[model samples]
Target: MTGEVRRAETDVEREDAFAVRFEVFVEEQGVPEDLEVDGKDDEAVHFVGYAADESSDGSGSDADPRPVAAARLREVGDATGKVERVAVLEERRGDGWGRAIMEELEATAADRGLSTLTMHAQTPVEGFYRSLGYETTSDVFEEAGIPHVEMEKSLD
Candidate 1:
C-alpha cells in the first residue's frame, strides 16, 4: 500500500509498466498479446507505481523497488487526455494501488492544464472508476474482445 506513483520518466520504468500490463491483460485476462502493446506507447505519457519495501526475505528494508501497476495517458484535444492500459498486478488489487495510480495521473493532468480525463473501462470495473469521480459516457462496447465503456471526469 506504500509506494510511489509517478509519470514514467525513464525507459526502464516504462518497460516495467509494460511488464505489468502483460501480467494483467495478457496472462490473466486472455487479452491477445499482439493487441496489448499498441503503437502509442512511445508518445503516450505512462505512469508506474513502485513499492519501496516489498521484500522476499521479510526484512523490508532497502529492498529493490518493484513495479506494481501501470497506466497510460495521452492528450487528445486541447484540454483533454485519454487514459488507457491501466493494469494492476493481482496481488495489489485490493490495496488502493489502482486509486493511487489514478490520483497521481490526475494530479499530473491537472498540473498540465488538462480540463478532462477519459478512459475505456471494462464493464465489471466501471464502478471503480465511478468511485473516482468518473461518469459513464458511452454504452457498453467491446475493445480487444473485452466489453468496455467510455468514462470521463472533468478535471475541475
Candidate 2:
C-alpha cells in the first residue's frame, strides 16, 4: 500500500478511527448500529491509515485523509488478537489501503505479545483476507446483517 498506516495512541484518536469504520460498515454497508459499536471499542487498540499526502491533523483530525482506513485489535484469551471493524473508504478500495490496514493491525498485534490474529471477515472480502494469510475457521454466518466467516492467521 502507498499509504501510511499506524496505531492511534489515545482515546480520541481511536474515536476517529471508529468514525471511519462507522462510515463504511454502519453507514455504507448497513451493519447494525449496536453491532458496529461494540464494547470492545473501549478495550481494543485502534489503527488508522491515511494517504501519505494527508497532513498530520494533530492526532485525529475530523477531516478525511485522502485515503482512509481503520481497524481495532483486542486481546483474545492469552495468545490471540481479535481484529474487528476494518474499513476503507469506498474510493480507496483499489489503492491497497485495506491491505495496508491489515498489515498495520497485524504488526500491532505482534507488538502486543499476541501470537495469532483472528477476525470475522465479511463474506465478500473473505478471499482478500485469505490472500493476506488468514484461513477460514468456520462456516459462513450472519453478522450485523451481513454474511461473515471467521478467519485466523499466525503472527509468527
Candidate 3:
C-alpha cells in the first residue's frame, strides 16, 4: 500500500478516525454503538491512515486522500500502552493499511518510553498481531460480543 499514516493532533483528524471506526465496527461488524465509542478517546493517542481516492478524479487528475483506517494507544499503567479501536475500511483491507497504523502506533509508543504494548485482538485477526511480534497472553474471551485474546509485545 502507498498510503500514509499520521498522528491525529486535531479534533477534525480525530473525528476522521472515529468515522472509520464507526463504519467498520459499528455498522459492518454489528458492535453496539456504546461499545464501539467508549468515552476514553479523550485520553488516548489516535492515528489515522489515508489512501488516495483515485476514483474521485473525474478529470484524470490526482484526487484527495481519504481516511481509511484508524487506531488508538492508551497508557494503561506500568509503562505499557493498550492498543484499541483498530479498524480499517472494508474496501481498504489487505492493502497494508492496518499494518501501517500498528507500525506508527508502535513507534510512537516506543518514543514515549513505553515498555510494552498490549491489545485485545479479535480472534480472527490473532495471527496478524502474532506476525507483528505480539504474543497471546490470555485465553480467548468475549469483548463487545466478539471473541478476543489478550496479546502483548515488549518494547524494551
What's model 2's lDDT at 19?
76
Q: What's model 2's overall lDDT?
A: 0.82
Compose the digit string of candidate 1's lDDT tens values, residues 1-156: 887888889888898899889999999999998899778888788999887767434456546677889998899898999989999999989888899999988988898899999999999889999999999999999998999999999998
Worst 10 residues of 3 by lDDT: 53-62
| Residue 95 in model 3: lDDT | 90
Runs with alpha carbons beyond 4 Å of true place in candidate 2: 54-67
The local distance difference test score of each candidate is 0.89, 0.82, 0.90
TM-score against truth, every candidate: 0.93, 0.87, 0.93
Separate clash counts for every candidate = 0, 0, 0
* Candidate 3 per-residue lDDT over residues 23-115, each given as its tens digit: 999999999999887889989999998775432333433365678899999999989999999999898899999899999999999999999
TM-score of structure candidate 3: 0.93
Error of 1 at 2 (Å): 1.4
- Candidate 1, lDDT over the whole model: 0.89
RMSD of 2: 3.6
- Can you rank all candidates by lDDT, best first? 3, 1, 2
